[model samples]
Target: MRAVYILPALFVAGVVALSSVYIVDERKQALVLQFGQVKQVVEEPGLGFKLPFIQEVVSYEDRILGLPTQPIEVTPADDRRLVVDAFARWRITDLVKFRQAVGAGGEEVARQRLDRIINAAIREIMGGVPSTAVLSEDRTALMNRIRDIARRESGSLGVEVIDVRLTRTDLPEQNLEATFARMRAERQREAADEIARGNEAAQRVRAAADREQVEVTSEARKNAEIVRGEADAQRNAIYAEAFGRDPEFFAFTRSLTSYERAMQSGNSSIVLSPNSEFFDYMNGVTAPVAPEVPAAGQ
Candidate 1:
């Protein structure tokens, strides 16, 4: 009977010992509750002791958790609709507040609150900027606003919001295709204009070369005519001096030349006056000498 009574007490002590001690790691927060009521919160890493069987320990993540906010279709101030992908990194900053307002380690409830806060922030800040600016030059400012608003709104929820960032912003495919077509057409027009200017320059060069060729050929022909005229004048001056020295021989020579030309090619008709230059060598024919025969076998 004594052994049985001691045995039950020892078992109870063991259970109490097991339930009293709780450990909080460096990356976690611990919450202590007594009979469903908040007792003490452990925000630092250590061993925490609580009442056995009546007290409960709840653990929370001390490090940042990535929470992807719901993608919402929002129209910017310029009335362009886009889907916004936003997420935040946060951690539990207050263990007491986490257990008091919302249940400790209540990820679902926390996510619901974040969703509300993030949506409200997007509507106020990102939705106010034009779609062009939100997706481009003003994206940094918009992200800053979202982070600020989320931090402020979540401060009371025992969560510390580190930052918010946008993942993607895009124009619809149809819009992108139309933009490409316009860009291509503009480039083609510029290329065509350049080609036209090039062709015009080439034509000008060719025309100038053609005109230069014509001028050079004409100058060469004129120089050739001048040389031929000088040669002809010199021949006439020599002929007149020769004819003055021996008029009769010159006439006879000239007539003989004309007769030789006339008899070489024709037995055709001819017309002449009696006193014409063609008669200058008529009736003054000379006999030709025959070759002498060789004596036989001398």
Candidate 2:
């Protein structure tokens, strides 16, 4: 009877032990609520106790999570409309603030709050900066300002804003055609300027080449004249040398050579007698061919 009573007490204790529960995880915060009221909040990463069936434990994430991006269009200071697409990263900070402003597991609601905060910052910054800066040059600085403002405004969500980013900014599709036309016109103007420059350079090169060709031809003609004059001088010197050796024969040979060159043309039609100065060589050089001789010893 004593052993049976010991087993019954052990069973009751086991039932009580089964009623109590605890859990530990690295990337989550646990909130214990008793009868629909906050009992305690545990943020540390270790096992924690909760009264099972009486105190309910709700777990919330602690990891960095992506906040949904929302498309927003706002006009800059210059009155240019910009379609801003943006998103952010966040995590729960204080579970109490999170529960109050955003209900349990209300990530979408939190994301809505984030969009409001991010949009306010964007509007404020966009209102102050120039359109050119927003569209191009100073976008980085503008992004930093937006991030700072979003983080500051995100505190109510019980989360830290890890980063804020702009996914895209585009003009309306209706305005896109005009922008494309303007870009095309600008490119055409640039191309025309480049072609004009190329034409001007080509003309300059052609003119320079023409001038060089003229100078080269002039120099060649001058060189040819100099060679001809030198050849005439050499001929005169050779004539003087040969004439000094035999004056009579040199004069005779020169006269005969002149006659031969003057009469060498195909159409040599002269009306001078054979004994004239031009044909004196024919009479002086040799007798005419003898008439065909009679048969020998006829």
Candidate 3:
């Protein structure tokens, strides 16, 4: 009978021992709570003890955690609306505070609260800047700013925000077509302005070229007329000089020239008298002699 009692006592003692002890995993921290109050926090990975049935151990991830936020629309300083998607890296820093802040709710409650804090920080920071800043490389600074704000706010919840990143920032789908159309119209207007300016410049150049051509042609014609007048004057002077040297010979030569021209046509329809001066050379008449040319010594 004593052996049976001893065996039952031993079984109860074993059950109590098993229930009082817990293993803390390397990647997680634990919190011991009794009657809805935090009694102890186990930060390191090892064996821990608590009351057999009155205390419960809650384990939370000690490693870095990830929280992806939902896409939210934000209006920047320029009043341009954009859809933003972001994520955060965080970890529980104070297990006691975490348990106290999210009593009976645990990591799930903490995550929800953290998500709100991050979203608020994103909106607040992004709303103050222009859309260009949000889209540019300066976005890294913006993310750092968001992380600081989130860290400050989430400190109350016992979580440290390691980093915050904006994965995607874009115009809303409804605005995409309108934005594209506006951009196209603006570019077309610029192109048209450029074309009009080019045409105006071309017209100016053509006008200048035409004016130059007219001026050059007029100057060339003036020079040609002057040259022709000079040549005519020289020829008349030479004819006068020959006439002065020998008037009779010159008259005979003129007569001969006139006769050849008057009878050049084979038809020969000239009704000139036989004694006409035009036929003086052709009639073999003796003409006045020309004065002899003086010798070089004379």
Candidate 4:
């Protein structure tokens, strides 16, 4: 009987000892709760105490945690819609407040609320800026703005947002084809305008060249006519000098030259008198002859 009582007592002591002591690790903090109410927070790493069988200890991570939200659609001031993928780095700052707000639901509840806060911040900040700015270097500023808003909003959950980042931003798939088509059309229109301007310039150049050619041709013809007239005048002067030097020889040579020219034509019919001066050189007659018609039968 003594041995049975001693064994039961020892078992009760062991149960009590196991229930009263809790361990906290360096990577985590603990909350002591009594009857579903928080009694003390164990922030340091080591052994801790609690009432046996009546108190409970909850552990929470002390390091930063990532809360990634689902991709959300947002429209900017430029009226362009985009899909935004983002995430937040955060950790518990106030253990007491954290316990009151999210200690019960633990990391799961904290993530849910933090996701909502981040999404709201992203929507509000992105909606105020143009899509071009969002895609530019200004995106850094926009992300910082989101982080500030998220930190403020998540403060109620005793969570401090270390940073907020936008991982990927893209135009909606449904709008890509339409946007590309519009850009192509704009480029084509600009190319056509350039071609038209170039063509007009080329036409002007061709017209100028044609005008220049006509002027050059007309000037050349005028110059050729002047040279021909000068030659004719010089020939007449030479002829007069020859006539003055020898009247009889000049007249004889002129008559012979005319006869030779008339006879060179194969089909020419001459009805001149047989004694005419035109044939005088051929007849070797020096006397002037009267003009006469040929006999009717001859």
Candidate 5:
């Protein structure tokens, strides 16, 4: 009868011990709750204890967590509507406040509240800026602003927002075609203007080259004519000098030249008189003989 009682007591103690002991994972935090109220908070990972059969433990992720927001439409200052998809990094900072705020709903409830806060901040900040700013490098600043807003709002939920990011920002599908068409038209108009300007410049250059060519050709012709005229005058002067030095010899040479020109044709029909001056040199009748002079000794 004693051994039987001892065995029953040991079983009861074992059951109580198992109920009081809990293991906390390194990546998680825990809360000790008694009668639906938070009794103790356990942030560090280790073995923890609780009152048997009355208290229980609730675990929450201690590491950074992610919350991906659904794609939402936002109208910017330019009135261009865009579809924005974003996500946030957050972590539970105060488990006591977290449990108090969300009650028995746990992290899921906190996440739902966080989602609302983030979406509201995104709309408020993005609506004030133009779509260009949202798509530009300034987007980082906008995200920071969003994170700050979310951080402030989420403080009540006992969570700290580490960062917020816009994963994708784009025009609505319905507006994509219209925007692309407008951009293409603008680019084409610019290209046409560039082409027209290039053509005008090329024409100007061609005109300059043609004018230069004409001027050069005209000047070269003028110089050539001047040289030809000077050559003709020099030849006339030489002829006159030769004639003045010996009239008879010049006449004889002129007669020989005339005869050669008249008979230069292989087929020659001379219809001139035998005494014609052109034939004087060939006839040898007009030849002049010089008178003999006495020697100096005589």
Candidate 6:
């Protein structure tokens, strides 16, 4: 009978002990609440104590978190509308403040609210900058401005914004076709200019080549004339020298040469007179002999 009573007493003690203790993981912090009022705050990891059956613990994450907002359309200072999508890295810094502000709504609700703050900040900053600035090197400065603003504005929600970034920015669907058409036209104009420049250069080269050809041909003709004149003068000089050596012999040889050329073919026709000077040698009529001259003594 005493053994049975001892078992019942031990079981009662076990229930009481289980309700008094709670385990907090390394990744979490806890708040002990009683009767809907805050009774204790547990930040450290491992086992913790709470009133049995009457107190409850609410756990909150103590690590960095992410909040991604949906893509939204924004107009820039240049009046260009763009579709923008962004995300933010954040974490709950003040547990007491966080719980007081939005603990009941939990992490999901907090994220929703954060999305609004980030979107509003993005629009405000992006709207003041030109589209070119957002797309150029100045984009870095614009993003920094946005992050600073989001961080400052998120402080009221007991959250710290670590970084803010835009993932994508592009023209709206309705504008894509028009933009592409304009780009094609610009490219075609550039191509036409390049072709015109190339043609001009080619014309200059062709004109130079034609001029050089004309100069070369004229110089060749001039050189040919000079060579022919030299040859004619040389032939005349040789004839004059031969005649001075022996005039009669020279005339006889010339007649013989002309006769040989005229009689080359048996059926060849000749219209010259038989006694013509050309046939003097062939007719056996030799050149006149020089009259003998007497010595001075005779």
Candidate that beats the other on lDDT, 1 or 6, i.e. the better one: 6
Ranking by lDDT: 5, 3, 4, 6, 2, 1
Candidate lDDT values, in order = 0.77, 0.78, 0.87, 0.86, 0.87, 0.83
lDDT of 5: 0.87
Per-model TM against the reference = 0.68, 0.71, 0.66, 0.64, 0.77, 0.81
For model 4, how does the per-residue alpha-carbon lDDT over 1-298 read when each residue is reduced to its tens digit?
8999999999999999999999999999988999889899888999988999899999999999998898999999999999998978999988889888975799899999899989999999999999998888557889999999999998988889999989888889999889899999999999999999999999999999999999999999999999999999999999889879987777776765555565564555767787766666678777443223233233
Q: In model 2, what lDDT does residue 30 have?
A: 77
Which digits, one per residue and each the tens of the lDDT, describe model 6 over residues 107-223?
A: 787798889888888899999989887767547777778889888887878789888888888999999989999999999999999999999999999999999999999999999
In the range 1-298, model 2's lDDT, one tens digit per residue, is 8999999999988876766767748888877888867889888888676776798777788888886567888888888788887778788888878877787656678888888888888889988876788778447778888989988988877778888777788897877899999999999999999999999999999999999999999999999999999999999999889879877667677665655555565544445566655455466653222112122222
| Model 5: how far residue 231 lies from native, Å | 0.8
Best candidate (score: TM-score)? 6
lDDT, model 6: 0.83
Candidate 2 overall lDDT versus native: 0.78
Question: Which of 2 and 4 is ahead in TM-score?
Answer: 2
lDDT of 2 at 272: 56
- Write down the worst ten-residue block by lDDT for model 1: 289-298
Root-mean-square deviation (CA) per prediction? 9.5, 8.2, 8.2, 7.4, 8.6, 8.3
Per-residue lDDT of candidate 1, residues 103-205 (tens digit): 7438668878988898789878867778887778557778888889988999888788888888766655656778689999999999999999999999999
Query: Which run of 10 residues does model 6 get worst, by summed lDDT?
Result: 289-298
